[model samples]
Target: MSQKLTLEQIQNFEGKYPKQLWHLFMVEMWERFCFYGMRGVLAIFMVDQLGLTDANSNLKYGAIQAFVYAFTFVGGIFADKILGFKQSLIFGGLFMIFGNLLIGINPKEFFYIGITLSIIGTGFFKPNISSMVGMLYKDNDARRDAGFSLFYSGINIGALLGGILCVHLGKTYGWSYAFLAAGVVMILGVAMFLKFKNELGPIGDSPLLNIAPKTRKLRELGVLIGSLLCIPFIYMMIQNTDYTDIFMYTIGPLAVVYFIYQLIKIPDSNAKSKFLAAFILIAFSILFFAIFEQAGGSLALFAKGNIHPSVFGISMDPNVVNNGANSLFVIIFAPILGLIWIWLSKKNKEPNTVIKFGLGFLFLAGGYYIFYTMRFFSDAQGLSSLEVFSLAYLVVTISELCLSPIGLSMVTKLSPKHLGGMMMGLWFLASAYGQYIGGKMGASMSVTKENATLIDKMLAYTGGYKELALYSLIAGLILILVSPLIRKLMREVK
Candidate 1:
C-alpha cells in the first residue's frame, strides 16, 4: 500500500485539495446518480405500475429508504473490522448495479429482490465512502469543512442529473427505462472506482492490528453471507409497514444505549464531551431530516397532483421540477456557503455546529411555510403555480446546505478515530429514523387516486405542511436557546 499521506506532504503538494478527493468525488457523484435516479420515481412507480395505494407506496418507499440507511451501520462494522473500506465500497456498488438491473428487467415480479439488493448495497457503499473522505484530512485541519462542502456539491451534481434524466425517461417512456439508466450509471461508478483505486492509496487500507489471514478471510465471508441472510427480513419489512415501524422503534433506543455505553468506556473527560455534543447534535438533526425528507414522498405527490405543470408557458414534469430543482439550487449555493464559512472562520465569527443546526431547522420551517401558502392561492382544481411550489424546494435546499454537509464533517471530527466508520453509519441511521418518521407523516397525508377529490387531497397535504411548519419553527427556537450549553459540551471541537 502507498504510504499514508502526511499533513506535511499534503501541504507541500500544490493543490487546493488532494487529487484523491476529486477521484472520490466523481465516484460518489455517480453513486448518488444511481440512488437518486431510482428514488425520483420509486413512489410513483409503486402506485402506478405495481398498483399500490398512495399510502402503501409511501410506506414501502420509507421502508426501502430506512433499511438502505440502517444497513450502513452493519456495513460500517464490516469496513472497520472485516472487509476494509475499499472492498466494502466496491461490493456495495456492484450490488447496487445488479439491483437496478433486476428492477429494470421486471419490477412487477422482482421488486422485492431489487429493493433488497439496493438496500444491502447502499449499506456497504454509503458510509464507507464518506468515512474515506474524512480519512483524507487530519483531525484539526481547517480545510476539512471546505473539502466536505466541495464533496457535497459533487453529490448534488449527480443528483441534478439523476432527478432530471430519470424523471424525464420514466415519465416519457417507462419506469423500467429509468431503472435501467440507474443501473448503467452504477456500473460506470464501480468501474471508475476500481480503475482509480491506487489514487485512494492506503486511506482505507486494512487496520494495522495483526490477525491470522485465515481468520480474517472467514470474517469477510461471514459478512457477505450474513448480509444475504438478512434479505428475507428486509423483504418482510418492506411488505409489512408494522415491521418497519417496529424496526425503527427498536433501533432508535438501541442506538442511544450503544452511544451511552461508548461514553462510559471513554476515560478522557474532553473526549467524552465531544461525544456528548455529537449525540446532542445527532438527536436534533433527526427532527430536521424527518420534516425535510417529505420531499421524496409527500412533497413529490403534491407536486404531481396539485402543482400546475407549466410555468409561464414552459411545461415541466413535476418529479423533475420537484427533485431536480433542489439539486440545482444546491449546486448553485454549496460553494458560496463554503466560502461564507471560510470567511466566518477567518474572522473567528463562525457559528458553532449547534447554531448551524438551529439555522437548518429555521430554514426547514420556512420551506414548509412557503408550501403552506398554497392553501390560500390554490384553485378549485387544487392546482398551485409551479413557480411558488418550486420556490419551496429552493428554500429547503438552503436548509440542507446548513445541516447535511456539516453533519458529515461533525461525525468525523467528534467520533473516536477507531470508531469513525461506525459513527458515520450512526449518522445515516439517524437519517433512517427520520425517513421512517417521514414515511408515517407522508402516509398520514395520503391521497389515493380513486377516493380523493382534488380539493380534498390539497387540504390533507397542505394541512400537514402547515403543521410541520409550525412544529419546525418551534424546534428551531428551542435548539437556538440551548445551543450555548451544547457549545460548552463541544469544547474545542470547532
Candidate 2:
C-alpha cells in the first residue's frame, strides 16, 4: 500500500528525490575528495616535502581533524538553533570551497586561511545537511532509513573517488594539481546546488527568514565590521603557520560545554533517555573510528612498507596500488551493505542500533588485530608483499561497513526530532575525539634509535593493537550488557 504523502510535506515535485540533498551530497563528495584525497598524501607531503617528522605530521593531522569536527558542535548549534540548516550548510560549504582553493594555491599566508575557513565551514556544513535529511522525512517514515542509506552511498562514492584520484594525481603529476582538481570539483558541486535551488524548495528553517532581508544584511555587516576591527589584534596573537593547533585548544572545550548544556536542557524523560544513549554512542563512535580510520596512517604506511603487487601480471606502481584498494572496496561493498541492511530488516533480524554499533567496533578491532598479527608474518616471511596489505585493507573496509554508514543513522534515529542537527553535531564530536586519539596513536609510532629497534617498533605497535582490541572488546561488552536498558529506553521504537 502506498503511504499517503502529507499535504504540508515538501513535495517531491519534478525533482522528487530531494534535489538539494543530492546536490549537497555531490558537493560533499567533492569536498571530501579534496579533504581525504589530500589526506591520502598529506602525511607523506609533510614528512617528505616539509621535512617534518612522522610524529609531527600525525599530530598536526590529528589536531586539524579534531578541530574540524569539534567546531561542528558550535556550528551545528548556530545552524540548528540559530541560523537553521540551509544557511549553515552554505556557510560551511563556502568556507570549505574557499579553503580548498586557498590551499591549492599553496601559499603560506593563504594556507592557514584556507584551512581555517574550511574547518569552520565544515563545522557548519557537516551537521546541518544531515539534519535536513531528517527534515525531509516525517515521523517514523519507513523511508527515513533509506534516505540515510542513500546518503551513506554518497559518502562512499566521494571517498573512494577522492582517494584514488588524489593519491594517484599527487604521486604522478603534482600535489598542487591533485589539490586543485578536488577544489575545482567541489566548486562545481556548489554551482550545481545553486542551479538547482528552485528544486530544493524551502527545506531549511532559517532563523532570520521571518526577519526582513535588510535587517539581516545590516546584522551581517555589523559582524564583518567588528571582525575587521579585531584582525590586527588577531594577527598579532596567531602568526602564520601552515599547521597549528589553535582551534583544537580554543574551540574544542567550548564545543564540549555546549553539548553538555544541550543534554541538560532536555525537558522530557524519553528525550533524556535518548540523550543518555547519545552519550554512550559517543564512546562507541570514538572506539569505532579510532580503529577504522587507520587507513590513511598506519595502514597506509603498512601498504607502503609491505604489500606485493603485479596487477594482471603487470607491475603496478605502489602508490596507485595502495590508493586503488580503498576505492575498489568502497565501490564493491557499499551497495552490498545497503542491500544487506534492507534484507535483514525484511527478515525481522535487523540488529538494534547499539548492537550494530558494538559490532562495528569489534569488526574494526578484529581487522587491526589481523593486520598487527600479520606483522608477525611479515617479519617471519621477509616483508610480505602487496597481497598481505591488500587483504588487510579488505578487512578494514568490511569493518567500515559495520561502523561508518550507521553512525549518523543512529544519531538521527535515536535523537529527538527537534534536535537532529545537534545530535549530528555531537556525532562528529565523537569523530573529532577519535581523530584526535588516532593521531596521537599514530604519532606514538614514530621510531627513534634511542627508543627501540625495528623489532621494538613492531612490538610497540603490537601493544597498541592489543590495547585497541581490549577497548573494542570492552565497548562491545558494555553495549551488550546494557542492551536491555537501552532497548527499554528506545520504547515502542524497538
Candidate 3:
C-alpha cells in the first residue's frame, strides 16, 4: 500500500511551487469563469431584459454581491467547525450549477431565485479554496506571496475568458446561452476537483474524520439541505432590497463582535497584536474595493451608454472591454510585477505589506482620476474614448497587484491555524461592505431624469469618479501614515 502524503512533506517541497498548486489553479480558473461570467452579466441583464432602472440594477447588483461575500463568512465558519474545505467546495459547486441552470431556464422570472443559490455557493466555495492554498506553504515561507500571485493570475485568466464570453454570448446569442455556459463550465470545474482532489492528500479532508462514518455523512447531508432551505429567504431579501440593507447593517457589527470574541480566546499577546493589524488592513480594504467595484455597477452602465465602441482603431463591444479589460491587464502584468518584487527584495528594497496596501489606494486614486478625465475626451454625442477607459483599467490592475494577493498572504501569515478559514472569510466580508457601499455610490451616480441625454450621464458618472479619486487619495495617505504602527504589530511575520 502507498503511504499517504503528509502536510510536512507537501510544505517541504523543493522548487518554487508544489505541483498541487496547479491543480487548485485549474479548479479555481474554471470556477472563476462561472463567477466572473455571471458577475459581468448581472446588472446589464436586469436593466436590458428585466426592465429595471439603472439605479435599481446597480442597487440589486450591490445587494447580490454583498450577500455573496457575507455568506463566505458563514461558509468559512461552517467549514472550520463542520464540513471542511473539500465538502464545502463540492457542495458549493453543485449549488452554483443548479443556480445558473435555473436562470438559464427563464432569466427574467428566475433571476433572484438563481442568484440566491449562486450567492450561497460562492460563499462556500471562495474562501475555503484560498485557505487551502495558504496551507501549501509553511509559516514564514517567503514563496507564499509568490504562490498566491500565481494563483491570482489563474483567477484572472478565468475572469478574462468568462467576462468576455458571457457578455458576448448574452448580447449576440441570448441570456439563456450566457447563463447556461456559466453552468457548464462550473460542472467542469467540480468534476476536475473530484478527479484530482486526492492529490491534495489530507489537506481539505472533513473535520469529522474522528467521528463515525454514518454520523459524518449525516452531518454533511444536513448542511447541504440546510443551505437549500435558505434559498427562498434569500430570494425574498434580494427582491426587497430593504431587507438587504437591514441584513448588511446587522451583519457587520455582529461579525466584528464575533471577531473580538475570537481574539480574546487567543493565548498569545503577539498573535493578538497581529490579528489587530489584520483587522486594520481588512478595514482599509473595504475602502479600496468600494472604489474598485464600480466596474460591475456604474461602469457597466457607463460602458453601455457612453464609451466609444472602438479601442484605438479596432472596433469592439464596450461591455466586453469593461468586463474583461482589467483581467487581461492583470494576466499580462501580475507576473511582471511579481518578478519586480523579487528583484527588489533581493536588494532589500521591497516595500512592506502595509506600504504595498497604501500604494494600492494611491494607484486606485490615479486610475479613477484617469476615469474622470474621460469626460474631456467626449464628443458632442457623449461617446468618450475607449482607449482611455482601457488605460484606466491598466492602472487599476496595478493597484490590485499591489494589495490583493498580498492581503491574502498577510491573513494567512498573521492568523492562528484554527482561525484560518474565518480570517480569510473576514477578508472577504470586508469586501462585502465595500460591495454594499459601492452599489450605493453607483446608484448616486445614476442619471434618473426621463429622456436624459448621454452627455448628462457622462457628466454625472465622471463627476462621481472624480469624487471617488479624491476619497481614494485621502485613504491612501491615512494608510501610509499609519503603516508604522501596523508594521510594529506584525513583528517578525514579514
Candidate 4:
C-alpha cells in the first residue's frame, strides 16, 4: 500500500502546477459546462417558452442568478463547519444532476423546482472546488496565480462549449435535450471527481475526524436533509421576485454581520487587516459584476431582436454569439495574459492586485462604451453590426481576466485556512448582489410599450449602456485613487 501525499508534499511539488490540479480542472470544466449552458438559455427560455415579457424575464433571470450565488455563502459555511469540501462538493454535484434532470423532464412545470435545486447545488459545488485549488499551492508560491489562471481557462472552455451547445440545442431541437445535456455533463464531472479525488489526500477530509464516527455521520446527514428541505421554500421565493427582493435585502446584511464577527475573532491584527482589504475588494466586485452581468439579461434580448445575424458576413445566431463569444475570447487570451503577468513580474513592473482590479473596471467601461456605440451603427430596422458586438466582448474578456481569476487567487491569499471556504463564499455573495442589481438595471432598460419597435429597443438598451459606461468609468477612477490604502492593508500578500 502507498502512503497518501501530505498537504506540504503537494504544495512543494517542483513545477508550475500539481498533477492533481488537472484532475480538479477537468471536474470543474464539466460542471461549468452544465452551469453556463443553463445560464445561456434562462432568459430566452422564459421569454419565448414561458410567455414572459422582456422586463419580467430579465428580473426573473436576476432573481435566479442571485439565489445561485447567495447560496454559495451558505454552502461555504456548511462545508467549512460540517461536511468538508469533498462531501459538500459531491452532495452539491448530485443535487445539480437531479435538478437538471427534472428540468429536462418537464421544463415548464418544474422549472422553479429544478432551478432551486441547482442554485443550492451550485452554492455547494462552486466555492469548495476553488478552495481546494488554493490548497494545492504554498502560501507564497509564485505559480499560484498562474495555476489559477489555468484553472480559470478550464471554466471558460466549459462555458464556451456549453454556451454554444445549449442555446443551439434549445433553439433547434428542444429544451429537454438542452437541459438533459447539462445533467449529463454534471454527472461526468462528479464521476471524474470520484475517480481522482484521492490525489487530494487529506486536503478535503472532514474536520470532524476526531469525533465519534456515528456523530459525524449524523451531522453530515442533517446538513444534506436540511438542504433538501429548503428546496420548496427556495422554489417559492424564486417564483416571486418580490420575495427575492426581501430575501436579498435581509441575507446580505446578515452575511456582513457574520463576517464582522469572524473578523473580530481572528487574533492577528495583520490577518484582520488583510480580511478588511479582501472585504473591500469583494464590495467593489459587486459593482463590476452588476455592469458586466448585463451579458445574460438585456444583452440576450438585444441579441434576439436588434443584432445582425452575421459576423464578418458569415451567418450565425446572435444569441449564440452573445452567450459564447466572451468565453471563447477568454480561452484564447487567458494564457497570453498569464504570460504577460509573469513577464511583468520578472521585471518588477507588474501592478498590484488593487491596480489590476481598477484597470478591469476601466476596460469594462470601454467595452460598455462600445456597446453604447452600437446604436450609431444600426441599420434602418435597428439591427446593429455583429462584428462590433464581438469587439465589445473581446474588451470585456480582458476585464474579466484582470479581475475574476485574480480575485479568486486574492481571496485565498488573504484568508486564514479555516475560513477559506467562508471567504470564497463572501466573494461570490458579492456576485449575488451584482446579479440582483443587474436584473433591476436590465428591467429598467426593457421597452414597456406594447408596440415598441426594434428601433425603440435599440435606443433604450444602448442608452442604458451609456449610463453604465459612465458609472464604470467613475468606479475605475475611485478604485485607482484608493489603491494605495488597499495595498497597505494587503501588506505582504502580493
Candidate 5:
C-alpha cells in the first residue's frame, strides 16, 4: 500500500498486535487439539469401530492424511490467486467445521467429506495464516522466525494433549463423541478467528477486494456464492477414496502445470530464481515426507502390536503408551529447537531452508536407524511391544523435529506469491506419496504369524523398517553434502 511498508513497520505491528496475539495462538492451539486428537485415534477407530483389519485401517488413515496435505496447496492457491488468503482461510475453517460435524453425525457415511474438508480447510488456513504472520514483518525481519516458532509451539500443545483427549473420548465415550469433540473445537477456532479479524487488521484481506469498487465487490460475492453452491459436484468427484491415486496424479499435475504457467506469467523480477529454487526444494521435501511419515500409520500399529507399555509401576494402554514419547519429545524439544535456531541466527549459523530440510531427513535417518539398532532387542523379544513403545517413537520425534515445523515455515518463506499455494499443494503431494508408500509398505508386512515362524514374521516387519531407514539415511546424507549448492540456488536469501 505505502511503498509495500518497511520490514521495521511490520515488526512493530507484531509487537503492537492490537489485541495480544494470544487469542490467535490459543484458538489455533485448541483447533490443533481437535485435529491431532482425532488423528491420534483415527486409525484405532477404524480398526475398533468400522471392523477393518488393523493394517487396513491404518492404511486408510495414512491415505486420508496424504490427501489432506496435498490440498493445503490448493487452498493456498485459491486464496492467493482468487479469494485472497483471509477469505480462503475463513472458507476453509468453516468447511472444516462442517466436515467435523458431519463426521460426528455419521463418519461412515461422510468419511470422505470429513477428510476432504480437513484437506481443503488446511490448504486455505495453514499457509495463509503463516503468510499473514510473515506480512506483519518487513523483509529480513529478525523476529519473524521467532514468531513462527511461537506459533508452531501452539500447534504442538494441542497435538500433545490430543494424545489424551481423542484416545479417551474414542475409547470411553464413542468414536462419534470423539468426532463431535473435534467438531466443537473446530467451531471454536473459527469463532476465535472471526472475533479477531480486526487484529489481523487487513493483512489477510483479498488485495483484489481492497482495490475493487463496491459494485465489483458485490459481483465477486455473487460469484463466490455460486461457487459455494457448486461444492456438492466437486464433492462427487472427490468422494471415492478408491480413486485416491487418480486424484493425487490428476490434481498434483494440474497444480504443477498451473505453477509453471504462473512462473511464465508473473513479473516478479526474481521469478526464475524463485521458481527453480522453490521447485527443487519442493521436489526434495516430498522425498523427506514420504518416508518420515511412517511414524503415525505403519509405525503406530507396530507400536501397538509389538511394543510393551508396562515398564515400571504404572500400567497404561498401548494406544496412550504408544504416542507417549512423541508427546514428551515435542513438548520438551520444540522450544529448545527454537532457541537453537535463535542461537544460530546470532552467529549467522542458521542453516538455509534446503539444508534445514536435508537436516530434517537426516534426523529422519537417525530416527529410523535407532529403530534398526534396536532390532536386536526386538528380535530377542520376539515382537514384544516394549521395543516399539520406547524405541520407535523416540526415534520418529527427532526426525519429525527435523522435517515437520521446518516444512511449514519453508512453504511460507520460499514460495512465490502466485504459486505459493500450489507449491504448498506440491509439498503436500510429497507427503501424500510418502503416506501411500507407508501404507503399501505396512500392508506388505502382514505375513501371518500363524503361517510363518515367529522369527520369520518378526524378520519381515523389522526388515522393511530397517531397509526404509537405511534408504532415508542415505538420502539425508546426499542432501547434506549438496546443501551448499541448494543454498546457493536459493540465490541469497530474501
Candidate 6:
C-alpha cells in the first residue's frame, strides 16, 4: 500500500516539475487540435454545406457543446472508479480519431455519428487527463498552479495551429480536408500518450484497492461496450434541440445531487471548506462561460457574416480570425501572465480565486460592450472592420487568462483527493449549461434568408451582445461582493 502511494513521487524528476508534464502537455496540445479544429468550422459547415438556417446551426452547435461537456461526468466517474486515467485517455482519444474520420468521409450522412463519437471520446479523455495532472502534485505543491498554466498554453498552441490550418483548409479546400486534419492530429495525440504512459507511473491508477483482476477486467469491458451502445442515443440527441433540453434538465439536478452527496461524505473541516469554495466558484463560472462562449456561436457567425475577410491588405479567413485570434493572444500573453502571477505570489499580493473569477466576468462583459458599441459604426452592409473583431478576442483572452487556468488549478487544490475527477467534471458541467444557454442566446439572433439583410442581422447580434454584457457585468459585481467570504471558505488552500 505504501509503495503504491509513493510510486509517482519516486519517479518524479529532480526539477521544478515532473517529467510527465511535458508528455501530457503534448498529448493535450494535439487533442485540442482535434477539438478546436473541428469546432472552428462546425458552425460554418452547418450553415454553408448543409444549408441549415442560422437558428438551426447555433442550436446544433449548442447541443453538440452541451453533449461534450455533459459526457465529462460519465468519463470522470469511470476514470475514478473503473478504468483509471491512462486507459480512459486512450479510450477517449481513439473515439475522437474514429469520429473525425467518419466526419471526413461523409459529413452529410454521418455528421451526427461523428459528433456522438467525439462527445463520448472527449468525455473520457478531457477530465481524466486534468485529474492526472492534479495527481502529479501534492495538495500543497507550489508548482501545481504554474504547471497548469503551462499546460493551458499548450492547449492554445494547438488551438492556434488548428484554427489557422484547419479553417484555411476547410474554406479553401473543403470540409473533408479540415476534418481529416482533425483526425490525423488526434492520432498523433493518442500515439504520444501511448509512448509516454510510463512517465505517468501510478498517478492514474484505479482507486479500488486490491480488486480482483478478473473483476476489474470485466468492468473495463463493460464500460467499453456501454459507451458504444450510447452512440445511437447520442446521435438522436444531437439531431434536435428537444432531446438536448431533456438531457440538460435531467443532468443539471443530478449533478447538484451528486455534489451534495460528495459534500456530505467529507469527514474533514478543511476539506469541507475547500469544497464549499469550489462549489461557489463553479456557480459563478456559468456566467463567465455564457458570455465567453459567444466566441464560437454568435461571434463566429458575426465574423463570417459581418466582418471583412481581409486585414492589412492580406486576405484572411473569418474562421481563422475568429478562432486563431484568441489562441494567438493566449500564446502571447500566457507566459507573461504566468510570470505575473508568480511575481505577485512572491510579494504575497496575488488575488484570491474568487477575485480572479470576478475579473474574468468583468473583462467578458467589457468585451461584449465593446462590440455592442461598434453597432453605431456599421456600414450599410452591416459590416465592421477586422480591428473590432480582433479587439474582442484580445479582451476575452485577457479574461480567459484570469479565469480558465486559475479555475483548473483551483479544482485540483480544493477538491477532495479521492474525488478529483468528478470535481473536474462538475467544472465542465458548468460550461455545458453556459454553452446551452449561449446557443439559445445566439439562436435568438438568427437571420433567415428572407430577413437576412446585413443591417438587420447586425442589429440582432449587437442587441444580443448588449444583453450579454449586462448579464456578465451583474454577475461580476455579485461575485466581487462575495469574494471575501469565498476566500475564507477556501481555508488554507491559497
| Cα distance off (Å), candidate 5, residue 311 | 4.3
Could you estimate the TM-score for every candidate?
A: 0.96, 0.86, 0.98, 0.99, 0.87, 0.96
Regions more than 4 Å wrong, model 3: none
Candidate 2 local Cα displacement, residue 461, angstroms: 3.9
Native-to-model Cα distance after best TM-score fit, residue 295 in candidate 3, in Å: 0.7
User: How well does candidate 5 score on lDDT at residue 98?
Assistant: 78
* Model 4 agreement with the true structure over 1-494: per-residue lDDT tens digits: 46888998888887667888889989999999999999999999999999999999999999999999999999999989988999999999999999999999999988888999999999999999999999998888878888888889877889999999999999999999999999999999999999888889998888898999999999999998899899888899889999999999999999999999999999999999999999999999999999999988999999999999999879999999999999999888888888788888889888889999999999999999999999999999999999999999999889999999999999999999999999999999999999999999999999998999999999999999999999989999999999999999998988
**Ranking of predictions according to lDDT:** 4, 3, 6, 1, 5, 2
Q: Provide the global lDDT of candidate 6 against the true structure.
A: 0.86
- How many clashes (backbone N, Cα, C below 3 Å) per candidate? 0, 5, 0, 0, 10, 0
lDDT per residue for candidate 1 within 214-299, as digits (tens), equals 88778778888998898898888888889888888887788788778878999999999998888888877777778998877888
lDDT of 2 by residue, 232-312 (tens): 433332232232355446555675676678778888888777777766767677767766665566555545545444544
Error in Å for residue 31 of model 6: 0.4
Flag clash pairs in model 4.
none
lDDT of each: 0.85, 0.65, 0.92, 0.93, 0.66, 0.86
What's the CA error at residue 228 for candidate 2, in Å? 8.4
Checking candidate 1 for backbone clashes, the offending pairs are none
**Stronger candidate by TM-score (2 vs 6):** 6
Better of 4 and 6 by lDDT: 4
Using TM-score, give the best candidate's number.
4
For candidate 5, the per-residue lDDT at 410 reads: 64
- Any runs in candidate 5 off by more than 4 Å, and if so which? 1-9, 13-21, 211-241, 268-271, 373-375, 378-388, 448-458
Query: What are the per-residue Cα lDDT tens digits for candidate 6 across 1-494?
Result: 22333664633547555777778988999998889888888888899988988888999999999889889988998888898888999999999999999999988888889989999999999998888887788777666777788788878889889988888888888888899999999999999898878766678877654888888889999999999999988899889789999989999999999899989999998899899889889878887787788777878888898887787778887678898999889888887787787778879898877888889989988888888876886888888878877887799889898899889999989998788888898999898888898889899877756856888888889898999889988988998998888889999877
* The candidate that achieves the highest lDDT relative to the unseen native structure: 4
